[model samples]
Target: MRRLILLRHAKSDRPLGIVDLDRPLNDRGKRAAPQMGAYLAAEGLIPEAVVVSPAKRTRETWEAIQSALTGPEAEVVPSIYEAPEAALLSIVQTTPDTAGSLLMIGHNPGLQDLAMRLAGSGEKAGRKRLSLEFPTAAVVVLDFEGDAWSTVAAGTGRLERFVAPRDIKIGD
Candidate 1:
């Protein structure tokens, strides 16, 4: 089985004169990213390989997540930034076979749409929640019944869980 982790970029600041691609994560995002990383460590959802979008906010989110837990081999893929579902799927198909699990930190509604499109079944409540919105700093863990990433197709993955910042508890 191959596990895929889809993480939406955390909240970001819309600074005047800065382009959207260069916006940095806001304070809340800084907090949420680490908390989400903690959740991943607690749940043992670490990936063997991570593919990240090259946007500033997404990169900052990865840095914050890394501060909490570090293991996965990551790379910056320029195509991931603001890509649509089809484009994202193309990226997934090209994943190396050596990596058992893959993680992607990117934007939405590409991530959201991809997650929804790929998931055929899973936790009922989580599926319902996912259909609504993929909030910033949210994550969706999906399991596909294939050894090769190239074999994954639409409506083929089982949605293991859907988690968001609000669902996590940060210690005081």
Candidate 2:
């Protein structure tokens, strides 16, 4: 089976003077990013490969999470910065098969839309919550039946888990 972890970029500072891609993570994002990472590590859900958007917020989120993981290397996908659901799926479908567990840190509504489209079924509450809103720093885990990334397709994944920073206490 192949596991897909879709992580939306953490909360970011508003883009006033800075360009959208250059906006850094806000204080809440900085705290939530590490918390999410620790939660994943504690659950033994580490990914083999991480694909991230080139945006500063996404890159920073990956950096914060990297410390909690063992050896997952990250690749910057410029297209992910503004990609739609279809484009995002293309990137995932092209991932090397050797990467059994894959994590993608990017933006939305692409990430949110992708998760909604790919997930066939799972925990009813989780699916319902995901359908509402994919908040910043939310992590959605989906499990596909096949062993290869190339086999991934819409409505083929089973939602494994869904977590938002609010679901976790930072110091706990």
Candidate 3:
């Protein structure tokens, strides 16, 4: 089985004069990003590679979580910045088969849609939650039955877990 972690970039500060792609994370987002990473680490869901968007906020979010990630493999892909769901899907499909797990840190709408499309029947509640909106610092874990990322398809993966910043803090 291959695991895919869909992570939405943490809350970003509104760009006053800052360009949309250059806006950094707000304080809350900064705090939440690492917490989410720690939670994932504690739960033993480590990814072999972390694929991230090159936007400022996404890069900062990844930096916040860097400490919690066990391995040293991470790639900042410019294509992920403002990418549509199709682009995101393409990136996932092209990932090497040897990598058992992947973590994609990117933006909303696309990420949310991808999660809903891949989720299994048992995760109806989580799917419903995702259908609303993907909040900042949210992580959804999906388990694809096939060994290769290219074989992933709609409804073929089960939603193993879903964690949002608020839920993590409440559990703490």
Candidate 4:
């Protein structure tokens, strides 16, 4: 089995003079990012590889989680920034079959779209529960039956988990 974790970058500071791609994380994002990392660690969901957007906010979010991830080095892919679901799908398809799990950190609506597209029948209710609006620092875990990333398809993977900072706090 292979697991895919889709994580939307945390809330970003408004871009005034700064370029959209260069926008940094806001205070809430800063706090939520590490909390997310800790949650993943506590849940023992460390991924084999982490693929992230090169944008500043995404990079910062990945940095917050770096310490908690006991995996190979992360790769910052420029194409992931503002990429569509298809683009994200292509990236996943290209991942080596040897990598059993992957963590993708990027923006929405790509992330939200991807999650909905990959959700299985067992998780239909969870799929409905997912806001079309994917909030910052949200994470969606999908489990695929195939060992290869290329074999991942809609309804084939279960939505094993969906978590956000607010859910974490409520559970606490």
Candidate 5:
């Protein structure tokens, strides 16, 4: 089984005069990112490989999460910046065969759309919540039955879990 983890970048700062790709995460995002990372560690969801968008916000999100996960080095993929669901899938399909699990840090509606399109079933409540909205800092874990990433396709992954910062109550 192959596992795919999709994490939408945390809430980003909307500073005037700054391009979207260069925007960093806001205070809340800074807080939430690590918490989500710790949650992933707690659940043993470490990835064998990671692909992240090069946007500042997404890159910052990865940096924040690294404190909690010892996953492999992340590859910055420019195409992931504003890619749609299909494009995201193409990236997934291209993941190296050596990786048993992969993590992607990116933006949405692409991340949300990809999660919805690939996940056909699993936990009912989580699926329902995911369909509603894939908010900032939200992470969806999907399990694909295929032996290789190339064989995984739309409507074939099972939603193993869907979590967000709100679901975690960590004290400052």
Candidate 6:
């Protein structure tokens, strides 16, 4: 089984002079990113490879998360920045087969759509929550039956987990 983790970029600060791609994560995002990382570690959901968007906030989110985890090869692909669902799908399909678990840190609409499209079966509650909105600093874990990443297609995955920063209780 192959696991795919889709993480939305954390909350960002929209500074007046900065372009959308250049926006940095806000204080809340800074806090949430690590919290999410800790949650991932606690749940034993480490990935073998990580794919990220080149945007500032997405990169920063990955950096914070990387601090809590170990030994995942990562790359920042420019195409993932504001990419459409089809473009994101293409990127995932081409991922090396050696990596059993793949994590992607990117922006919304695309990420949300990809998660919804790929998940054909899973817990009803998780799917219901996913349909509402994919919040910032949230993660959706999907398990695909096939071994090869190239064969992964829409409606072939089962939504294993859906976690958001709000769902995490850090100090507990």
Candidate 5 local Cα displacement, residue 23, angstroms: 0.5
- Clashing pairs for model 4 are none
Q: What's the CA error at residue 131 for candidate 3, in Å?
A: 1.0
In angstroms, the error of model 3 at 4 is: 0.3
Q: Give per-residue lDDT, candidate 1, residue 7.
A: 95
**Pairs of residues clashing in candidate 2:** none
State the lDDT of candidate 6 residue by residue for 1-172, as single tens digits: 8999999999999999899999999999999999999988888889999999999999999999997788575798999999998999999999899999999999899999999999999999999999999999999999999889988899999999999999989769
Model 2 misplaced stretches (Cα beyond 4 Å)? none
Better of 4 and 5 by lDDT: 5
Model 4 spans with C-alpha error above 4 angstroms: 170-172
TM-score of each: 0.96, 0.97, 0.95, 0.95, 0.97, 0.98
- Which candidate ranks first by TM-score, i.e. highest? 6
lDDT of 4 by residue, 1-172 (tens): 9999999999899867999899999999999999999889889989998899999999999999889878878899999998998899889889999899999999998989888888865466667777455789999998989779999876677889888888885245
Residues 108-154, model 2: lDDT tens digits: 99999999999998998998999899999999999999888988999
Clashes of 6: 0
Model 6, position 145, has a per-residue lDDT of 94
Instruction: Report residue 108 deviation for candidate 6 (angstroms).
Output: 0.6
Q: lDDT for every model?
A: 0.91, 0.93, 0.87, 0.88, 0.93, 0.93
TM-score of 3: 0.95
lDDT of 5 by residue, 96-161 (tens): 989999999999999999999999989999989998999899899999997799987989999999
- What lDDT would candidate 4 get against the real structure? 0.88
lDDT value, candidate 1, whole model: 0.91
Q: Which stretches of candidate 3 lie over 4 Å from their true place?
A: 170-172
